[model samples]
Target: MAFFTKEQAKAAARRSENMLDQVAGLESYSDERFDVFLSHSMLDQDLVVGVAMLLKEQGYSVYIDWVEDEELDREHVDKETAERLRQRMRNCSSLIYIATDRSGQSKWMPWELGYFDGYKDGGVAILPLVDTVNSGFDGQEYLGLYPLVNQVNQRLYVEDASKVHSDFWAFVNDPSR
Candidate 1:
């Protein structure tokens, strides 16, 4: 997995901020059942939950596999489970893939991303949540091929949770992304 420099990350963040300002009041256009479908490795459950909580606090409705049903084993994807995942992907306005080291080897994260990509083309915002350790994003060559959230650092920039929330909503609501 490769990473992006701080300069590149800042540039992306600036672009996203500018775009958010341009489309500040377009939330009404987003009518998806859920604001975001947070895709992550089951191993990163703690981090995923933290991110979900932060988004929920900002008044964003987030959908995660664990929140749906504990008994639903994702390891073995039955026909019903597959359908359920598909439905959830369709309902969400965007998909934010928690791109941690664990997620790099996840069986479900890539599948979920591919599913969402096929479902909406460029309509749904597909973003990646990189680690904040070094403020550098690894696996950019792979994840960068698709649309991603713009943040100051490699992380979600949750230090200012509102900015993350607003940027995500703006990205998803904007059809021109």
Candidate 2:
């Protein structure tokens, strides 16, 4: 079956061109305000919250899925929540995945990484971190991250908050990225 009509493709092309013009208009202050989505595991909850607070303090609209409490009756990492988080990521200008050595052990984290991998090829900006690499680190499934690594624009150490923001802003302004 055909994925898109010829006319639909042409309209999409036109919309992309218009978006370029809009992006050019916001080139100056792109860093001050951007659509950001945070993909992180529960193990890294503290780090995610800290980053969210910092971004909010800087006046950015950050979408952190784990920041809000989930319904107790439903499975915390069920399909519903994943889809909601995926929607938020799709709407954002950038995606940030908080990586810890323990990330590989969790079933949901790898699934989330797969979602980010798809976005990277679509020209979405992705930023990932390697917080630690010990016993905890060895347990991490670096294999899962291999596909997205090439798409990563910045590989900051987890402790570096300033660097994360800097890279995030850079992605926001980079037209080719």
Candidate 3:
């Protein structure tokens, strides 16, 4: 097998960098403690995993579905689990939504958005990462579909995943200003 050409290697490196950029606090903020809620479609697992890892490194509690096996079966999603996630979303100082694909009719993403919608006034911040340009022929598009938060709408998008992490952190760190 031939090694990747220089251009191929550079492309790979750029992709890696883009993955890291999807979330903001990957550098280990051992001193700052914050709760982060991650909402996204399963189609965007790549970006979600990156954000989760970065937030975990930053000493932030991250509530990510599917990662850590927190995802509940559609039929088994009891009230308790819903409440737990809801509470996390409502109380988390920072809410990061990896909206890389359409969550229009997703299993739980819309609900997560609803939770954030209710607590927008509590200073709960909302950050979105649009990692993908399109989610294959699902016949659904997610470029501009934003989760509507109460009076305040806070969402950001990036075609590159590497940059999303830093932007997310910046939003979480300075949500008010």
**Candidate of highest lDDT:** 1
- Listed in order, each prediction's TM-score against the native is 0.66, 0.50, 0.49
Screening candidate 1 with a backbone cut-off below 3 angstroms (N, C-alpha, C), the clashing residue pairs are none
Q: Judged by TM-score, which candidate is best?
A: 1
User: Across residues 1-177, which tens digit of lDDT does each residue of candidate 3 receive?
Assistant: 011122322333345454344434343222333466677677655555555554554455665545333344656779977776665555566665543335454678656755675666433333343323221212133322432121112222212222222343444555662
After TM-score superposition, the amount by which residue 7's alpha carbon in candidate 1 deviates from its true location, in angstroms, is: 22
TM-score winner between candidates 2 and 3: 2
For each candidate, the alpha-carbon lDDT, in order, equals 0.58, 0.44, 0.46
Model 3 residue 177 CA deviation (Å) reads 12
Collision pairs in model 2? none
- Shift in Å, residue 115, candidate 3: 1.7
**What TM-score does candidate 2 reach?**
0.50
lDDT of 3: 0.46
Backbone clash total, candidate 3: 17
Kindly list the per-residue Cα lDDT of model 1 for residues 1-177, writing each as its tens digit. 122233333444444444333433433322337778888888866566655655564567777766654456766879888777888778777787766667777887888888887787654433444544246554645576554455444333221223234344565565653
